[model samples]
Target: MKRIHAAPGTISPVGPYSQAVISGHLVFTAGQIPSLGSFDEQPESFKGQVRQTFANLAAILETAGSSLSHIVKVNAYLTDPAQLEPFNEVYREILGHAPPARTTVCVQLWGVSLEIDCVAELIAKENGQ
Candidate 1:
């Protein structure tokens, strides 16, 4: 079992860290921030922030030979729990019926309102490519 880092220049990393890692048949992604191309601005829109965070997580998962459909678990941290409904709406859109086990909690943060971290089980058909 070896750790695989899911970083391919799309996801944002403020410090020295890999975006995600694959161990055996599983992929574990680091916390994702809402960042666009410039990587300096996190928009004021809470919904936009949540979407961007998921996008970052998706990008990392793609690099690890996985996708949102393969996600088995997700842990989200939000600066405000009031935005949870919007977040849930987006989650339903992305994951459809096959939702992963998830936990969302409020946490103190700066310049951002949401963060998403995920674990995915890479399908064997998509592995060893």
Candidate 2:
């Protein structure tokens, strides 16, 4: 069976989807944007937007009993190819020590510059610790 997770203090999904779902020991998160819990407060700059997006991702992950450090894979979408490096700068600041495997692609997004989704193991099961 699968369990759904919704982080408190985060923006609710605008569509028909849960924030994250846990099946077995894995948690799958929906693509997160840079709204920072409110569409009205979305950041304007690229790096700022990236920070907010990660913050959103982190919240959902924590709610699912996982964390950034426990992620096993990630999929990132970028509106502009030039922003990858800037995004990585923030990524390194947060998850750089032992970042999860990730695949990033350039694509067009509406109202946001980037989006991110990830798959992670529950914290208690991380590295069998």
Candidate 3:
């Protein structure tokens, strides 16, 4: 088992929690927000915020020997119900055609538009070791 700190180019966790954890073939990620662990200067647009959040998520997953394509489940939190369709647009663009199973809900997010976390399988080597 391994605990992951923030990856390069990603925001560090501001509290007492790891960015992700690697256990056997799975990687469980912490909720990723748009900022670099700060509440100031959050993206003004919903899509922009979503993109930044995913970027942070991808960085941590990669550091855990996983990629976005390896994700098996996702839990997304949105602060606005009206942004669901717009969020889906960006989600499709980034996650591609076959996205993982997901559960998204509108919630009260402090100083941010959204938060995302996921569980992903580790990418295997070509040798399948």
Candidate 4:
């Protein structure tokens, strides 16, 4: 069985998808964009966008009973190749030494410069079920 999750305070999905879904011990998150409030508004700086995207990803994972530290893989998309260094800097700061495996690629995006999605290990629920 699978469970869908939506994190409070995170931007709602712009399409017909849940923020994250869990099956077995794994939780997968939807691609999170740099929308601080509404999807119409995006951060101006590439660094800011990346930070917010990770923040959103963390929130979604937490909602699904996981966390940034539990992430095993990440898929990131960027509109500009120049942003890669800055994105990496922020990624290191957020994920620390044990960062997950990641792949980042330059791609055109609508209204935002970057998007990120991840998979993480789910924490056991109360009662150990």
Candidate 5:
């Protein structure tokens, strides 16, 4: 069986998808963008966008009974390659020691500067399983 997770404070999905789905010990999160309220209100700087994106991802993971420390893999998409350095700086601060394996690529995002999706281990079993 699988469990779906959504946080009321986090941005609602813009498409047909849950914020995250937990199956077994793994939590899979949908790609997160830097929209705390609405897509139109995204941060102007790449650094700001990256920070917001990570915050969104963290919220979804927390809702799924996981955390950034438990993340095993991440996939990041950036609209510009030049944003990589700033993104890395924020990523290191948020992830801290023993960061997850990550793959980042330059891609065209409509309005946001970047998007991130991740997979993490559940910190605890639901209802003790």
Candidate 6:
């Protein structure tokens, strides 16, 4: 059977979707906005939105018993193409050690400038210790 995970202390989904769904030890997550338990339209700036999105991803992954380090792939969408450089800077910080296979694209999002979604594999601790 599959399992679903919802992070602690996060605003309930504003739409019809779970924070994450796990199947056979792999968790598929939905796109995460820069929202921090707020009902407002997110994404204030390139850097701000990117950071918050990663933080949100981290929280959901932690809740699902996984982490960014375990991520196997990431799909990032940018509203403003100009922020690619700054975005890469931040990405290097988070994805420095073991970067995952990723694709970054600039797409239109209801006229917004940022959005990100990633897939992280569960790295079970050796011996379950």
Best lDDT among the predictions, by candidate number:
3
| Cα lDDT tens digits for candidate 2, 34-126 | 986586678878889888888888888888888989999999999988998998999999889999999999999887888999999988854
Global lDDT scores for all candidate models: 0.79, 0.87, 0.89, 0.85, 0.85, 0.79
What is the Å distance of residue 124 in model 6 from its true position?
A: 0.6
Clashing pairs counted in every model: 2, 0, 0, 0, 0, 0
Superposed by TM-score, candidate 2 places the C-alpha of residue 70 at a distance from the truth, in angstroms, of 0.4
State candidate 4's TM-score: 0.90
Cα lDDT tens digits for candidate 1, 1-129: 544454555644667777777887899888888887656777677778777778778778877878889999999998877878988988888886899999999998766778789999876684454
Question: Ten consecutive residues with minimal summed lDDT in candidate 4?
Answer: 1-10
TM-score of 1: 0.85
User: Which lDDT tens digits does candidate 3 get at residues 1-129?
Assistant: 999987887767779999999999999999999885565756788889898888888999988899998999999999989989999999999886788999999999877889999999999989995
C-alpha TM-scores of all predictions: 0.85, 0.90, 0.93, 0.90, 0.90, 0.86
Model 3 clashing residue pairs (backbone): none
Local accuracy of candidate 6 as per-residue lDDT tens digits, 1-129: 344445875566767778888777787788777776774746676777778889888888888879988898899998777889999988888987988998999888754467778888776978862
RMSD of each: 2.4, 2.3, 1.3, 1.7, 2.0, 2.2
Name model 5 segments beyond 4 Å from true: 3-5, 125-129
Better of 1 and 2 by lDDT: 2
Selected candidate, larger TM-score, 3 vs 6: 3
Candidate 5 lDDT by residue in tens digits, 1-129: 465546756867777888898888899999989987877877888788888888888888887888889999999999888888999998999886988899999999777789999999989665675
